[model samples]
Target: MSIEREDLMICPARVTLDAAQMAFFDGLPTKAPSVQAELGCELEQGHEGSHAALGQQVDTTMWWIQWTLSASEINPYTWCPATHLPDTERRDDKDCALFNGHPGSHSSAKRSWQASEAA
Candidate 1:
């Protein structure tokens, strides 16, 4: 089945960077803006608390970045090829409202846990 891009609601893709990469990204003050302009979407920096769960202490100094996607730019099914078919189909039915008020859903909990353990 083919899906129309404009009919899909897209969410931001969050990425966690290692210390070195974070440093590079931060070193260039205009990096975020440049990326945002090129992608035609917001590229935001997430806070530490958003990186880990409440009351959790993390050791590694990782930085979080989010790339906001527009409905015309992403098709959940195509973007997340490994995601279950049901989930891909659900995005359209739900109008991508699934992430409302759910910051935890976007948090890099797994990455934080792994980084902390590695430290």
Candidate 2:
């Protein structure tokens, strides 16, 4: 089964899943009675599947994407920039992005996060 590349999480890191691995990911269900479809993360530096649960849960601590990346060729780690004020000089209190109270960091002090490594 070939999954749409656009449907993947919008992360810069390499999605190194091979055909077989992709087949496995494609075959897995995104939702269950308790689990919901994990939407792709839009944050510039957020980790893949950070915005949603992309894969089924393998256990209490990890999900299927995590399992797949363990063997795939990706960066050593994924550290996304917390949401920051687009203009830190002014009194702008709103986040640069529309999302608020999201996961990861949202500290007003942070002006930006790590520079993107790849497209």
Candidate 3:
């Protein structure tokens, strides 16, 4: 009962990262890390910048499809924007380190590192 994902639809959202963030990302390793990536994510693509630059986003639960989008393609509106939730009473004041519109659960919802928690 497994579906073939080779033909699944993908999200096409693309945005520009702000100058500071883009500059920071450009400094990270693109294919291999000559320096420590400093990221603390647990996903296979979460290790280093070089690895991430070459990896594509792969979560199916998000309202936006990102299986075909590259990690390099995502540029959040801002860090810890907290604009995704519709709830008025969650009362979670902890901010996520990942950018807005990131895939998977927010960092505030979990203690460990996640796919989009990279800075």
Candidate 4:
């Protein structure tokens, strides 16, 4: 997915929401997506030495039941901060959604643009 200019501000370090804000997540409607299990994790170097940031990586599996929870009958997909996104690009193949709608684009295009080595 293309990273919007606003996405540059997205950081996991700044935890703005308070405990009360997350209290409702526990009561998320039955249809709400659930993190039933954490299959595994792949850690990468963080900006600081010896510290790693946790972002979804290959071999890390999360099972979710798609659901639309509402507040005052309004779906809050826009306000929900925990939107799911893959941390790394895998491939353009069907098995991978790195290029789900961009058929002709090379899977390594982003990597080349970013000038980073593959994981």
- Whose lDDT is greatest here? 2
Model 2: how far residue 83 lies from native, Å: 15
Candidate 4: residue 52 lDDT (0-100): 15
Task: In angstroms, give how far residue 48 of model 4 lies from its true place.
Answer: 25
* Clash totals in order: 0, 1, 4, 0
Kindly list the per-residue Cα lDDT of model 4 for residues 1-119, writing each as its tens digit: 88754234222232122343334344554332322222111111122211111111222221111211221111121111121345434322222212122212212212131122223
Ranking by lDDT: 2, 3, 1, 4
In model 3, which runs have C-alpha deviations exceeding 4 angstroms? 1-35, 38-77, 83-93, 109-119
Assess candidate 2 and give its TM-score to the true structure. Answer: 0.24
For residue 93, what is the lDDT in candidate 2? 27
> What are the per-residue Cα lDDT tens digits for candidate 3 across 11-118?
223333445444555554443222222322321323223111111112211111112235433322344456346643322325443444455444443323233333
lDDT of 2 by residue, 1-119 (tens): 87544334334443334566456545545332232233233333464343322233222212333323444321222222233544343223243321333354332321121111110
Task: Please list the residue runs of candidate 2 whose C-alpha ends up more than 4 Å from where it truly belongs after superposition.
Answer: 1-11, 29-64, 67-70, 73-103, 106-119
- The lDDT values for all models are 0.27, 0.33, 0.32, 0.24
Model 2 steric clash pairs: 38-53
In the range 1-119, model 1's lDDT, one tens digit per residue, is: 87544323223334333454444444543312212212211112332222211111123222223233222222111111222234443232222221223232232112233333434
- In terms of lDDT, model 4 sits at 0.24
Q: What ranking of all candidate models by TM-score puts the best one first?
A: 3, 2, 4, 1
